[model samples]
Target: MNEDELFEALKATLLKEDREALQRLQDILDQPEKLSQKMSPVLEERLATFKQAFPKEYKGIIEKIISEKLANSKEELLEAIYPIMGKLIKKYTALQFQLLQERIDQKLKFGIWHRIKTGFRSFFFGVKEDEMILNELMSSTIDNIFIIQKHSGLLIASTNNNPAHQDDLLAGMMTAIKSFAEDAFDKNGAELEVITYDNYQLLLESYYSYYFVVAVNGNISSHQSAVIHEKMNNFSAKYLSRDKVKSGQFSQALSINLKSYFFTNPIA
Candidate 1:
């Protein structure tokens, strides 16, 4: 065999092997499953590296873009949320109103029950309804009672045994305060009925000849006030007379009677 012929045969053999190898490579590319099997691990490794790096590299950029978009849409966002806020407020107000109504209903129901119980007690126990209510709800003490001449400010009679001068001074002060109140609001021409300070109350009752001032301490209910007024009226009718006014002083017997009427029992 010649050298050129041997070389050509050797090159042809190498080319055939190369062609077979190339055909095998083309088959792998044509088959999708084979291609994916070869590339999947490499692609997964690259994806994992990207995921780890993306937060460190691109996080700031993404946040800035979102913030800018929100800032630009602020007005639109408020417009969307305003209705929701109004609904929440309305719901809260409705709930509060319902709770208040429930409380009022409870009080009214309690009041009805109380009235029924009071009626039963009055019918069976011979206790006056209003008097019973005052006994339970009111507490008070009558400290002093004074009868003073209306215009002249003369101390006619007193429950206090203090000197006549102190009684006269107290009478003058009360007269002056009454005059001031009447004069200050003369348009209504209303008489001064009460003067209160802290837990003390001075109840005043006016008559044609004189007025009375009763010093009271502690809680006063309307029923208790009515009872006190009625008691004062009775006292005035029974004790006050022409001779009593002319004397302008409390006799020892009169003083004892006054104390017995007011101080012996509670106002009820």
Candidate 2:
């Protein structure tokens, strides 16, 4: 009906499995008699401890409670959703702190390709040598890499003795991208996708809203891509807040805009 409703519907449809799990989680919200007995003493103790440590923190907590209650003043009987939201926030914040406490380098990262620069210029220019290298490097495993965005149209990364036109290869890739975008966005929201070529090659494809497309290749499997997807989801949940200014700042810090720089120096 409304934007929020449509967004929720789209999310549920796209992430049917996840939505199912979330539905199971929602069942816990019902058994309130059990929840009241279970939650009362724990919440009181934590509130007391937090207040003793920092009285100022208690003020925000209380203000959040009041604001939630005021917002739901329409109902004759309002639910205790405020305390639940607050508790969840506190637990999640603590969990994030624990995750951050570990060494930075050892921290797990998404398996997405970190860069999309040409795999090797020589390989593109020298087609036979490049194919040999690709076969050697990727023979043992399936190469699952896909291009997210062509950094500079299709430059001759390497040359082969044959006289195949580079322009044809580039045109085909562009056509594939257009098809991929149609299939991907019609189903999901404005989101990146983890694509596979066969088994050993993985491509991380991202669209810049409605402007440009980007892709990168990597030597990873579909299973590995799933893991990376989970990690990226968590990263997004933890960092991308709803506040406009905060979102903008985080976008600048983490976002990539390659449309301009990528096309500036194209191969003739």
Candidate 3:
């Protein structure tokens, strides 16, 4: 009791407040509910005060530091981004070029460029009703249009009023020549669009039940060819699609349409 009691008295005197605080901390660690109860209000109030004060205290300072960093590193940023941007532009350009090539192929495949050297008057001048024929296209004449039946070589209708051969014979001859060419050339059911001879060229366009044979007298230009194609398409859509034919003929109407045909219209 003498020495040990003396040491205990001195230790307790020196560490009384610290020992009590440590015991409270140990108790808080042991009981989670009590710890939360004690900490919650203080923590929430501090967080609220921090949120209210943080932007006022630090926003301008943080913004200034970031702006200075970005200003100094601008060239570095551009250098890092340029390779990626160039690759993206290159890929986009390649896609656009592929689309352009496909369109050009379609145009060329349909004889769109077929007399390209001739006739640019339509582009330079405005046209109405497609009545004007270019003098450069006078070498060709819209001779006749024949509406002929398939397989039987029968004439449905014709714009040709008088001819060396009868309508039926002319129709039969055309069918025979077409069949011979298909057999020889392995045409594979493609419409024999044009048959060029020394004095004439025949433009053929087949419909569902019948076919059209446009007889041309001389060398046709690209403009003339396109106009003729457009005329046949328009006439067929208007007259041929309907049941206006009495016993399979709209010959007089077809004649009037052919009479209206000229060398040029607006190309588009």
Q: Highest TM-score, which number?
A: 1
lDDT of 2 by residue, 1-268 (tens): 9999999999879999987887766765678876677789999999898879785657789888888988775221222232233344445555654443332223213312321122344346654432333333332322111122223222211111233544336434654665567566776443333334544333233312111222334353222333333333333333322232221121323232222222332211
Model 3 lDDT, residue 99, Cα:
67
lDDT by residue for model 1 over 1-268, one digit each (tens)? 7999999999888799898999988988999998899999999999999999999999999999999999987645543443344345445545664665566456545788787998799899898765666555457888898787777777777777767548778988999999889899886746787899988999887655567788988877654565666666667766765446554554656667777777776675
- The CA root-mean-square deviation of candidate 2, after full C-alpha superposition on the true structure, stands at 28.6
User: Which scores better on TM-score, 1 or 2?
Assistant: 1
Ranking of all candidate structures by their lDDT, best first: 1, 3, 2
All candidates' lDDT scores? 0.73, 0.39, 0.65
Best by lDDT: 1
- Please give, for residues 167-265, the per-residue lDDT of candidate 3 as tens digits: 768888998887787778885666566888887999886554566788888766554565566566565555553233325543666555554543233
Which pairs clash in the backbone of model 1?
Answer: none
lDDT of 2: 0.39
Cα TM-score per model? 0.47, 0.23, 0.43
Q: What is the alpha-carbon lDDT for the whole of candidate 3?
A: 0.65
Q: Residue 180 CA error for candidate 1 (Å)? A: 1.5
Off by over 4 Å in 3: 1-138, 163-165, 242-268
Q: After superposition, how far is residue 223 of candidate 3 from its true place, in Å?
A: 1.6
Give the runs in model 2 whose Cα sits over 4 Å from its true position.
Answer: 1-180, 183-192, 195-216, 244-250, 255-268
